[model samples]
Target: MSFRKRSEVVNTRGPGLQNARGPTQDSIQNARGIPANTRGMPVNARSPVPARGPQLNTSRGRNVPSLNNNNPSFRGRLSQRMSNMNINDDSNSHLNNHPGIRPSPATSQLTTSTGCNDLDSLLGHMGLPLGNSLLIEEIGTTDFNSVLCKLFASQGIIHNRLKNGNSQQESNTHVIVLSLNKMWGKELPGTYKGSKKDIKKQNIANEQSKISVSNLNEQSSTPSRYKDLKIAWRYGLKDEIGQKNSKSTNQDSTEYKDYNHQFDITSRLIPTPTSDEITYIPTNIPVSSILTQLTNAIDKNPTKLIRIIIPSLMHPSMYSPNYFKLTEIIPLLHGIKSIIKQNESRCVLLASCFTNLLQSSISSSKLLLNQIQSIFDSIVLLEPFQQEMIQLLEKSYKTQPNKIQHGLIHILKLPAFSEKGEMCVSRSEYAFRNGRKNFEIEEWGIPVEDVEEDENKDNNVDSSASNIGNPNNKPKKSTKVDLEF
Candidate 1:
């Protein structure tokens, strides 16, 4: 028996074995051409795994998965489960804290005063809701809306200072001002001193505290009424007294204070060198960089509340008349909305835009403004106060003669989550004025002429009585007041 070298020998005993070898050789021959370009590759190299579905060999087509396919891998399933788990956990935690905070569809439950009580009353949230944007839209060419923006900024500053115990040092919050141009800095609203109403309320609360202290002392000295005291010395009478004393001391030392202020638009906020509370950013900065800088500033002070005041959002100086045409506005607003939601606990945004700018744009692109407006939590349109309405308001309210009438506060939209979010409510109209010391919003009342009509009827009877009492009952001739040349 002669045995050949193992590499050269080919075993063929049964026909079945030869049949298997025939198929193997054919498969080898089919794969050999695939790696022809892959020089130095081993002939015994493993074949590529087959694709799940039949594939076409189109030159431009890629070997991607089918469009309507599911990822059934273990890793994919695990990631999906993790995302669902996280969502459920977040929902459960939010529901747990639901009692403490009321959820708003349009705005956050948290709110800060607009610094003007009347304006607060007009808003559904009773103030500027946090984590929401307040849009101030003006119809005409007046800087009155700017005054509201200033007041909003000033209030935040004042509240921050007051929160820090009115310290002359640094404040506890940040005020970011996106000024349309250089003029806004010179005209920033000033911090308001306590108004007469604020002072009066403070005094009343103080008086009540004193009275309560006196009453507590009197009660302590009167002695316990229970005669069946099992442990007069050990019944915790001493502990109770000590607890009360400690509570009183704590109350006295750290009384809660309200930081809501009434801002004065006529004066400028006195910039203190040490207190860098207000940060001014030029509106001309690139839209992409705006949010980045804002994020950096906010992160710098993680614990501080943030107030962003954007005045004249699309002013001609900062942007072209056709600025909305640029795609940047959409992303900019979306980014801002995201930021506000992320920091809803301590962030508030107040922005103003002139309606005329949108109106003058091509009618087809008008929806851009609406889309922008929709992103905001609330919208307030300031129409030029009707001259007749202003006169009527002036006559009815009898405000100071020198007070310049502001604008009509038309609440176009209220925060969806607010207490009274209805937009159909009657006479949501309000008249605002820039007084010497304050910016005020008041209910727009019916004209005084109507009220005078009833008074005139009463006066007719008085006139008849006067005539009856006097000897001259004859009516006086009508006198023409108009003089013609």
Candidate 2:
């Protein structure tokens, strides 16, 4: 309210210039050398200068000190209240109001959006909808890395969707996945990046290409900065009531439809993710690593869904830390079974054991019989021969190693067990070319076998007089009935 006086205004005391009109034309004429009116008046007065009028309510008006100058007196009050309570700039306050940009629905984790749907179905909602940590199990493939990407990306998706406002959609959802298995190159969508994905989406500025969960090469600190499912769901649901839905959906749902029906694949996990960001593990992944992942998931949330897939080619030794002892692995698997039955979340498991390792390794006796069956949502056992196969394997290893080699490395070209169903490379062939690294298709399918060679010679010998009483065989019903001495 108070204004400081400048020296000229306060101290000037020029005799002729004292404000009674400093030297008008008449006075100027009297002055001896008054430069002949210099065209007639002081330049400023003749120009478009403003005239003095009503003085503003400030100290400058009176050039005097008073209580009202700095502070209002008790008797005097403000004539008009402050017009508006506002500052000249607002950028800082706006940012302060929203401390976080991408607020997670739960725990306030930050995340980007992924533009795909095929990836989100298996993983819960985007932004990782809290509550349960998914224990993913890949089946019929090496796309586990891709699946995990989607899993992590779901966190981003859920985060943005639930809390970021539905009108300004998310462009990409990035997933941070840990992989113990080398993933197929084609699994990740070719155009994978940060903001680049945002441009790919149409219209929705926030749409960050549907879930590009980052793939960290090195594991970061333990407390992952992400939201759990419940919070993610709330965030993802925010604008979804009226926003555009994702274009991509499950492409391979059918493959897993059979998986759900036959291979113990999770109902929600069906139609595995075909696109997403991921890190791939490339060597013979130790079975220990897979168990560790499941254990970690369990440690985080025992009630979350769990899934597992194992290749038939894995040898007993591949499960080394536990010494490939079916005994040890079977117990662990049995434990999973008990847990699944007791929880709200689901558990699904798949393996070539349906052919190579089932009875031999998974169920040597009746011990794990019920536990193994109940643990998996469904079990697709594809033994080419419906009858017992170990006897046939024993015969092949003996009579004709050539037949074993011919049926496997040659005719079938897949080195699995004698069931003649699973045709995967055996892990023991570590010394061979490429060894037991990424999955190799050369070990699965074979051209239909010639009936003569494919027949169970062991059964044939047993059916004939030569095999009637072998220890592995039993007496015929006719023999027991015809004992009418």
Candidate 3:
């Protein structure tokens, strides 16, 4: 805020002299020796002149601070103070204060839930990676796969409304549902609280383990005779130490364990009055316009996370099967891919398409899907069981009364940037069942009957023959029985 005054040049010479060298006007007048052509003006008007400001001054063309002057150090110190400040830190803090906005995950953990806890773990990252797109391919006409989409949207809504420890609600994240269908928001899946039966079973299992350990300790410590009192004391002491260790471990697991959330499809996840987390965009709008709108929505809350759900994308019922052709779908998905990469910290994209529609024309579908899959960071295919696969499942889980909805979770692509080896990949079948509460997923064992394929084939052949009856043997005599009215 302070300004330094310019150094004044003192004119100490006599009036007739100009700085002890050049002739003054009085000297010129007295001499009468100046020519009219060059009397009042210098020869070159463009010549450089000394600066009149308080900045560094030099006799040569450029200003160089004199080494004797201490002012240069003061200027250097001022610049150093400015450089030490972080502009990003100030801008980030300002953006974070906007209601419903969140800071980018660049410095924090870059993961969010895929909504389904089981699916999240399966995807790796134990949640969806921020700024990546996930493609879900559901085989056949069954829209059961759409349930995953709903859970994704519902989970986002729940995450957006969560309040911090200080009881202040942060800016909610936005969910945009892009689809051709109109049934989106009507039946969004509700939040899932874990089942009471499952919780009780886990508790019971933990109790049983504790009992078995206690019994083993008791058997090992039993004394053969009262003479071994010292040995008995030692055994008792070991038993007590082992019990304490087990109890401490159990306590730790109970206190710090994190659980996956399951959502109910019977109801919807209602948004708060102040924030509308879900926005349904109709596919009728041009894709260009859709992108524009999406850009605007993201700009509205640049600091917050955004979840984009494109349900039943390119479904034949919604759009013609030909639309999935490379000429069309590729460019569209490419645009989306660019957007995802550009705003990676704040946005995530999820798209689903019925795998059956793509398979209608095998070669083209395969080619198209392969290309489309390349655009996404993760790709998952849910294939319903083949007849043989179904039979094997039935034979394996027959003892268990609960009907297991059978499907193969073909992980076409694992979660983003996972470097895990194929040996570590999970081949566990995705077993799920719809209940009053919500859909639940569990790791299903590979059917044991797989090793007995030949045996199963023989059994199937015999059953077919019995059902068809003997073709070679002659006809049986019909017994005519009369029924009285």
Candidate 4:
């Protein structure tokens, strides 16, 4: 009986003891796994975790704000600095009100007229862009390029007159001529009046209109008067006529401040510009001194658009032989470029040079010419027709003298101030004629005589082809007999 009782005592702690012992062992193991720093913490408590930096949203994949905002990183600081700086503030706003300046048709950059509409068109931007320089080079000794310079100067004067409106105190444009010519103002060309034919037609029309008006009073009661006054309502002619009248009025209002104007080369500009409007710089001075004078002129007229015309650049009569050296001329041009870039919104430069003066066959001379051209934003080369070529053109255009071209114009470079900086340097088939009323540039074609000769050759070819199948037009038999085969 004692042995049976000892076996039954072990069975009391089977399921319940095991369940309680399992939890106690787990608690001890967890306590041992924790570090010494967290030994006294509650069993169910968690350790503190550090806050994270900026993160991307999982759903949208966009940047999320940083948890800490006290000290921003370098990138954040840089972004803040950039947003504070406004570089182009009001730079172009002032240019909009300038009467001489207008938006370029191709690039929308503010452009000023070259005084010659045809020359402006040749620049490819419809006008010379502000802050640009144009270099006109003539191959011969002829002073044809001077006409363009005068036109340019005249345009500036006209624009200044329009902008100031009889107020001599305030000037809108300042023309600085680097020459000793004191009577430069007197040489500027005049605005073109209508040609003789056009004037005659206008006078005849005026007289006819007056006659018709006087006759209208007598015919007012006649049925024919009513018939003449009848409106073409079926074709909406009344609306078209009204629109045309309104358009004419609008054109008249805007024509006074036209960007380009027709000029008569034979006549002088009326009401020549005052001394205050134009300044002549003595070219006999040192190049540095000349630059200083230009800078001073620009500084004095800060509010006005400055047109710097350096006519006959490095001419023996205008500039000393020392000034023709590369060391001297390069710095002068560089200084001018610097000025233009500094006052990029308000300044333009135009210079003309005779290439024959610089012997381009030599490397040094060629290098000098290239350097000069490189400084300018646009370069045009004038090759006047030779005497024989002129004679040929005269002969071909005997019936229409105006159609003959005096010279060929080559565009070496185009103005490139736009955002795209696009430029074209190609052999353009363009010819220019200095007309009485206007400087004309047109597409060049062969002479009419050559065209006629080509036509005759084509006719000969046609006749030869026609004779291919004709018996009467066949080739004649050989006079000498061929060798026996």
Candidate of highest TM-score: 4
lDDT per residue as tens, model 1, 313-420: 877777655356647677877887798788777678898999887767657457888888778877887776767767766775565565445566777676654335
Quote each prediction's TM-score.
0.56, 0.24, 0.58, 0.66
User: For model 1, what is the error of residue 396's alpha carbon versus the real structure, in angstroms, after optimal superposition?
Assistant: 5.9
Ranking by TM-score: 4, 3, 1, 2
**Model-by-model lDDT, in order?**
0.66, 0.33, 0.66, 0.80
Displacement of the residue 200 alpha carbon in candidate 1, Å: 16
Q: How many backbone clashes does candidate 2 have?
A: 56
Please, what are the lDDT tens digits per residue for candidate 3 over residues 284-387? Answer: 65668777877777777766678899888886666655466788778778887788778776678888987677777557778887888778878877766678
Write down the worst ten-residue block by lDDT for model 2: 431-440
RMSD of each: 16.0, 30.2, 18.0, 12.7
- Superposition error at 175 for model 4 (Å): 0.6
Question: Could you give me the TM-score of model 4 versus the true structure?
Answer: 0.66
Q: Name the lDDT of candidate 2.
A: 0.33
Pairs in steric clash, model 1: 104-417
Q: How badly does each model clash, as a count of residue pairs?
A: 1, 56, 4, 0
| Candidate 3 residue spans exceeding 4 A from truth | 1-86, 89-109, 193-260, 270-275, 320-322, 361-363, 387-399, 403-405, 418-444, 448-485
